[model samples]
Target: MKKITFSLACLLIATIGSAQQDTYVPKKTNFFSDVMFGGGLGLNFGNEFTNISVSPTALKPITENFAVGLGAQFNYLKSKGYYESTSYGVNILTTFNPIEMVQLSAELEQLRVNNKIYYPATYVSNDFWNTALFLGAGYTNQNVTVGVRYNVLYKDSNLVYNQAWMPFIRVFF
Candidate 1:
C-alpha cells in the first residue's frame, strides 16, 4: 500500500512539473506603413454645368490598415449657354481597411471655382466655391488598387449630391 501511494504522488508531481515547464508562443499580427499615389477621372452632371475632372492623390498609412492623406483635383467644363471655368480643391481624408485588399474612406474638401454663375441672369463670377464631404470604397492587390466614391455638397439652404465611379491604379515602392 505504501509503495502504491508513493508512486502515485511521484507521478502527479511529474505531471505538474512537466506542464509548468512548457513554453507558449503567441501569434503575431502583420502591420505595415503604406504610401500610395494614384490618379483618376471624374464626371459631374448638374443643372448649372456638366464637367469632367482629373484628380491625383497621395496617401500615407498611420497603422497596419488605416491611413490619413491629402489630395488635389482639377476640373474643366464647357457649356453653350454658360461660361467655361476651371476649378480645383484640396481635401483631407481618412481611410480604413477592414479586410485584406479592401478599404473604406471619408473625405472633407474645400473647392475654389474660377468662374461661376449664381442664378438666372445673375452672373456671380467669382473665385468662390463650397465645401463637400465624400465617402469611398475600394480594393487593392499587391501593387494596384481601384475605387469609387459618392459625394455631397452643402450650399445656401440646399443640398447638392453626386456620385463618382472612379477606377484608379496605384503602384507602391
Candidate 2:
C-alpha cells in the first residue's frame, strides 16, 4: 500500500512539473516603428569573374525573434572588363534563440537587379536577378550579431547558379 501511494505521488508531481514548463509562444510587435538597419560586404565568384558587393538592409521586428526587412546591394566587378549592378529586395526573417548567445534564422527574399555595362550604350531591362531563399545560423553578443547565410537562386535562365556564404552584422537599438 505504501509503494502504490508513493508511485501515485510521483506521477502527480511529474504532471505538475511538466504543466509548469510550457513552450514559448511569440508575441506580435509593431512594424516600421521598431526597425533596425545594418550592412555587410561579400565576395562573389562566378564563371565570368569575381566581384565584391556592399549590401545594406533594414529589419523590422514582428515578434521577439521574427522580422521582415528590405535590402539593397551594389556590386562592382574587377575582371574581364568593368561592370556594375544594383539589386533591391525584401526578406521575411525568423530568428530562433535556443540559447543565450546563439540564434538561427531563415529568410525568404525576392530580389531584382539592374545590370549595366560600362563600355558602349548597353543595358537590359530584363537582365535581373531572381528571387532567392536562404537559411542562416549565428551567434549574438550584447549589441552585435554576426551570421552566415546560404542563398539559393530559384530562376537561372538569365543569371548563373550562384551560391554565396554571406556574413552579416546587425546593430539593434
Candidate 3:
C-alpha cells in the first residue's frame, strides 16, 4: 500500500511541477508586422562640393535568416567648376544572416546620370549609365542595423564614383 501511494505522490508532484513552468508558445504573427523597413541617407559639403543622397528600401522576410527587397536611390551634387548633376537608380537587394547579430548583404544597381562638361565654348550635357555591385557586412539588432558597403566596381577619378564605400543605418518600424 505504501509503495502504490508513494508512486502516486511522485506522479502528482511531477504533474504539478510541469504545470508550474510556463511553456511559451509564440502566437501567430501578422505578415505585415513581420515586414521590416530600412534605408540609408548621405550628405556632404565642402568649399566646392556638395552632395546629398536618399535611398529607401522595404524588405520581406523569407525566413528568420533571409530577406529580399527593392530600393530606389537618388543623388544630387554641385561643384564649383562642374555643373550640378542628378542621378537616380533602382536596386535589388538581398541579405542573409548567419547569426543573430551579423549580416551579409548584396545589391545590384543601375543608375542613369546627367552631368555637364565644358565644351569648346559652352557646357554640354553628358549622360551615361553606370552599373555597380555592392557587398557589405552589418551589425543588426531588433529595431536597428548599421553596416558598411563597398562598390566592387568602383573606378577612381570616374564621375560615377559617388562613393567607394558607404556606411548605412536602418530603422525598422
Each candidate's TM vs. the true structure?
0.55, 0.53, 0.70
Residue lDDT tens for model 1, 1-173: 99999999999999999999849886664533356776558798887767898877777878888877778988888564666677788888888889989978788888787775446666656666768777778797765657777665544432123233334354444
Q: How far is candidate 2 from the true structure (C-alpha RMSD, Å)?
A: 11.7
lDDT preference between candidates 2 and 3, better one: 3
TM-score of 1: 0.55
Give me the runs in candidate 3 sitting further than 4 Å from their true place: 1-33, 42-50, 118-121
| Ranked candidates (TM-score, high to low) | 3, 1, 2
For 1-173, candidate 2 gives per-residue lDDT tens digits of 99999999999999999999968988775556678877668797877777777777777766675666666665555444555555656666666767758777777766676665556555333466467677788889965778787776544364433445677666665
lDDT of 1 at 128: 67
| Global local distance difference test of model 3 | 0.87
lDDT of each: 0.71, 0.67, 0.87
- Over the stretch 1-173, how does candidate 3's per-residue lDDT look in tens digits? 99999999999999999999989988988877777777778899999999999988889889888998888999998886767788999999898999999888898999999888765568888798888999999999986779999999998755877689998676766
Clashing pairs in 3: none
Worst 10 residues of 1 by lDDT: 157-166
